[model samples]
Target: MTEERGDVQELSDFELAVYEAVAEIDKAGGAADIGTLTAQIDRPEEEIWAALSHLVSANHLHSTADGYTLGPHDWAP
Candidate 1:
């Protein structure tokens, strides 16, 4: 679910951070799983899960059986 261009700004800071975490992991040739996200983000695991869910819903991140990755969108900050 790719969000529209105008909706890109609707992403919250934590959601964006989650998305960036996935991006970084993908860049490093790794999948952004719960453990990786938990290690990279200082927040509690529950908060990280919430942010990841929001990011996936907002189309900023993609979730697969492996883990999360950057979603299909062209928008950049």
Candidate 2:
């Protein structure tokens, strides 16, 4: 399927936090590892993981051996 783009503008607060956490990892040149995300979002691990799962289902994120990362279409306006 084609990639999604800029689809998170209307995300809920929790999803937005998840996006920001992922963005932080991207900025740091690392994957959105669960440990990194939990630290960045300052939330419980399970909560962050649930958000990440939603992101994955929504096509805003992808998973790899390294960890989760922003999907290709995430930056689209």
Candidates' RMSD to native: 3.1, 2.8
List model 2 lDDT by residue over 1-77, tens digit each.
77655457656899888887787777778888887776667778898888888888877888889998878753433
For 1-77, candidate 1 gives per-residue lDDT tens digits of 53443265787787778778889888777679999889888889999998887777766677889898877766452
lDDT of 2: 0.77
- Backbone clashes, candidate 2: 0
Candidate whose TM-score is highest: 1
Which residue segments of model 2 deviate by more than 4 Å?
Answer: 4-6, 74-77
Alpha carbon lDDT at 12, candidate 2 = 80
Clashes of each: 0, 0
lDDT for model 1, on a 0 to 1 scale? 0.78
**Candidate 1 colliding pairs:** none
Candidate 1 versus the native: TM-score? 0.79
